[model samples]
Every structure is written in structure tokens, then in C-alpha cells.
Target: MADNLTKYREKRDLKKTAVPSGGASVKSSNGRRFAIQKHDSTRLHYDLRLELDGVFKSCAATKGPSLDPQDKRLAVEVEDQPLDYGDFEGTIPKELYGGGTVLLWDRGYWEPELNKSPEQALAKATSSSLLEGTGCTVFVLVRMRGNEDEKRTNCS
Candidate 1:
């Protein structure tokens, strides 16, 4: 049993890429860049990631936009996220580490209501909006405020 556990840990560790210091660095399929961070909330939450293509999009697990039992409450929004946000998994190492397991919940492309491609969505930014009828209840749109030429840094 101990050997199995050790091997499992080793494999998990190997799967972890070197996150950037300001945040967790992720490379999308098209070679685009993004970052992710997990919020240490009582109910457990993870921030979905994508680069500042102009803004940071996010979502969380909570009662959401409504409290009705029939109403699903996962919310997604756009907000300003630190570039170093990605390395948050073990931040609270002692309190919530071992008991929690990380998994990929879902992934796909999203289209904004404004006819903006994912790349153009960042320009005409406002607060993130929740998409109804979509699996998650709330969604937000955000825009990046600075020059997009910043170099990516290592997360160590």
C-alpha cells in the first residue's frame, strides 16, 4: 500500500508544470497562455483560467445568483487576477491539503453575447455576467488594463 501511494504521489508530482510566480501558468491548445488559482473557501473553489486576452474570466462554486434548491449555483465572472495566481493549490498546505482532490471539471469555448470572439471580447469590457441556461449560473467579463507585452515569468 505504501509503495502504491508513493508511486501515485510521484506521478501526480510529475504532472505538475512549473507554475509562474505571480500565478499558475497554463498553455492552451492553440499555444495561448493563461493562469489559474484555487480559492481556499469553505466549500472549495477553483478559478478557471485564460490569459489577459484582455480580461480575466472566472467562476466559483457557491449558492450562486439564486438560492432556490432547483437553481444550480455555480457562478463564473470576470475579474482582475494576479499573474502569480496559479500556484495556489498548496498555499494552505496544512489545513486543506490531503483531504481535497483536484480534478478537471470541464472545458470548452465560450462566445460572448456581443459578437466578440474570445480575443475581441476583452476590449469592450464591463463586469462579468452570468449566463443563464448554461451549466454554470454566473459569468463575468473583465478587461486587462495594461500593455499586453509583459513577459511571462516562472512561478517558483
Candidate 2:
């Protein structure tokens, strides 16, 4: 767990930031929760964080995830965040790393389709995921064909 948060801690000072600085383990029953945060940073984008292992596997969507089946959004993988980070909604100082206003846009549980483990699917992912949130249910078709850092997905 400490190994996973190494990069996260290095990016920001725990004393100044309002975000969680990871150490203790967060208990979870299924560990299938996910959150989409709308961040107003250097640019406007949505942050998608999926709970995996003991942390949140993060990514930022430039145009945000679309509900239209034909719309594809560009998403880039980011550093892992603590589980509690999903509930954060505040303003980060302008001088800070992720300096901006963050709003918890959507949050709930998610389950990978085909009965496969999330870790197994994400590492070599080219599958569908069922994201059931409080506001809506999104059927996400995630594809990671090569070694590219960016991912384009059409969520319906």
C-alpha cells in the first residue's frame, strides 16, 4: 500500500494540501467503487478514479466522459490517489500541483464485465465496464491496444 502511494505523496506536500496523504488502509467490502470529479485547473477536465487494490486508479478526461454512444473522449492516466480522495470537493491553492476547484461530479460502484478481476482487465484491458452511479449508469468500452499513455473511449 505504501508503494502505491509513493508517487502520490511525492507530488504534493501533505501539510499544505487538503487531500489525503495515505498511510492507514481503508476497509472495503468489494472495492469496486469509483468516482468522477470535475476539476477546474489549468484547463477544464473530469477526473475518473476507480478503486483498485487499496487506492484509486486515476485518469483525467479532457472533454469528460460522454453519455452519447458516438462521442469518444480523450483520457490520460494520472497518479494513484487515496480512496478518500474521491469525496474531496474544494479549491487547491494556485501554486500547488493540482491547483484548482474540484467538484465531486459523480460517484458510486463499478463492476467489470465478463466476470474478470479489475486488475487483470485493466492491465490488458479491451473490455466493457458497468459504472453504476447515483445519477446515471454508464456502459464504458475501454480499450488499451498498445503502450500509449492516452485512451479514447466512447461511453454510453
Candidate 3:
């Protein structure tokens, strides 16, 4: 059932791009894949993607991560967006579709501070926990900090 949905999504008329050169710092050691997509929904939102156990887990936010520990933001759990959503960038026709822009945000594996496995981290994440109060969904990227001696990469 999920496979069929994935196939249908892939066939949608949306632009899709693989990880650009230097986009990924390193492949996931755990074999999980992930992507970050900027969605042009009614209001712009960042769609964080994490693939685990053959399923795509997703969350969304209108803003990026907050530095202040007190600032509570809630992230909404959205449907599993298509992988092609990663590269989708353009204006949706205002008449037929609401106009908006989409860009790649980030892509990597799912790593959590508490959980050692991707599944564990995913299982631990819930709409209430992720949403918290600020409304920002937290997603675990596979790459570890300081894993590479390279500078941070940002998605335009």
C-alpha cells in the first residue's frame, strides 16, 4: 500500500533533484536516508524528511530551530511528502494553485541524542513532543556534528 503511494507521488508533476554535489556530508552509516524540502503550502513551511525502516517520516515548521531553550515551538506532523519534493522550486499558479516557493533545506540520517538507533529516535518522536509549544517539528539528521572537518552547508 505504501509502495503504491510512493510510486504515485513520484509520478506527480513536481521537480525532483537528488543530493547535489557536496550536499551530503556523508552517507548514513545506519543505511537510512533523509531529505529536507521547503514546501509552498498556504504558508511556507520547512518539510523535514527522514526515511527509516522503509518508511518516510515527516514534520513541518514555519521557522527554523530556536536557540533559546525556553522558546517552545511546535512542529506539525504532515503526510509523507514525495522525495521529489526536495528539489521543488517554483511558483504555483495563483489561479490553479496557490503561489509559493519551495527549496531544499537539508538532508541526512536520523540521529538523536538519547536514542542510538534511527527507529528508536523515530519512535520517540511524537506530534506532542515535536510540536511542543512553538510549533516546530524536530527531525534527526543522520550526520553527526564534527564528523567532517568541513564547513556547514545551507540549502538556498
Candidate 4:
């Protein structure tokens, strides 16, 4: 892996937690990807993972992803995870670090609009302290049930 998943590996014991101790990166025909997971730990939370630097940059949203434009959910940044962790879905034993079940909510590639390149967009966000959740307006779209429609939502 281009990024050392030290924290990711250090957090859990493979013998106890179902979470993987990831190593080495895989190349997919698909481009940069992202995954949203429903994590039932100490409290229920939705995790957002963006593929970057060969690792999954993570964030946690307690209220989950919003489908309304006016909603600005609180998202706090978390440690990076292994890219393979995107596929993880199972129960971590009660004695484990994150002791609970995990569900994969969504997984897909991201399409950036602001900068000429995806890298540039990431760079811009980082340089402006946006990646650190400073002056950052994160917009996410989720297709709600009943009607297939898109809505803009922000996270900080």
C-alpha cells in the first residue's frame, strides 16, 4: 500500500475482530472509489471512506448521510483504513476494538467537479485546510427510496 495502514492494523486484533489487517494494494479497472458503511459500534454511525494515497481516508457521521440540501451533518475525520476494508462486512466480537456489526452501505468511484483533475481537487481541499474540515463544504448525494431522485447535502 502507498500509505502505511499502521493505525488501521494497530487498532484491531485479527484474532478477535473480523476486521482485516490490510497489506499491499490492488489495482482495479475502476477508478478512485469511495465507500459508505453503517457501523454499529458504541453507537450507530455511518462511515465515509474515500480512496486516496492507496488507502481509504475515513470520516464518521453520527446522524448518517443526509438527503436534504439544507442538512449539514457533523462529520469528524478518522484514521485511514485499508482499501480492502471497503469490502468488510461482519460482526466484530464484543471484546474487540469496534465491537459490533458493520454493513456496507455504498461503494463507487467519485467524480470531482471543481478542479481539472481529481488530484487537483484533493490538493485544493488540502491546501485550503478543507480536508481537515476547516471551511469545507462537503456535498453528498444519495438516492432515497420511493422515488429515484438526487439531493445535495453538506458535511463538516
TM-score of each: 0.35, 0.87, 0.51, 0.73
Please provide, for model 4 over 1-156, each residue's C-alpha lDDT reduced to its tens digit, 9 standing for 90 to 100.
634677777777876666867754556736677778899999999988777778887777898765566986666667788888888999998778888899997776665444435555443332211221212234443312222352422224
lDDT of candidate 2 over 1-156, digit per residue (tens): 778989999999788878778765566655488899999999999998888888898888878767787887767778889888988899988789899999999998888878777876565557767788886577474745544453543222
lDDT of 3 by residue, 78-131 (tens): 555444444445655433332455665555443444534555554432311122
* Global lDDT scores for all candidate models: 0.38, 0.79, 0.46, 0.66
Tell me model 2's lDDT, rounded to 2 decimals: 0.79
Q: Give the TM-score of candidate 4.
A: 0.73
In model 4, the worst 10-residue window by lDDT is 127-136
Global lDDT of model 1:
0.38
Query: How well is each residue in 81-109 modelled by candidate 1, as lDDT tens digits?
Result: 33343333443322332234333333333
For candidate 3, which ten residues in a row score worst on lDDT?
125-134
Q: Between 1 and 2, whose lDDT is larger? A: 2
- Arranged by lDDT with the best first, the candidates are 2, 4, 3, 1
TM-score of 2: 0.87
Which of the numbered candidates is closest to the native, going by highest TM-score?
2
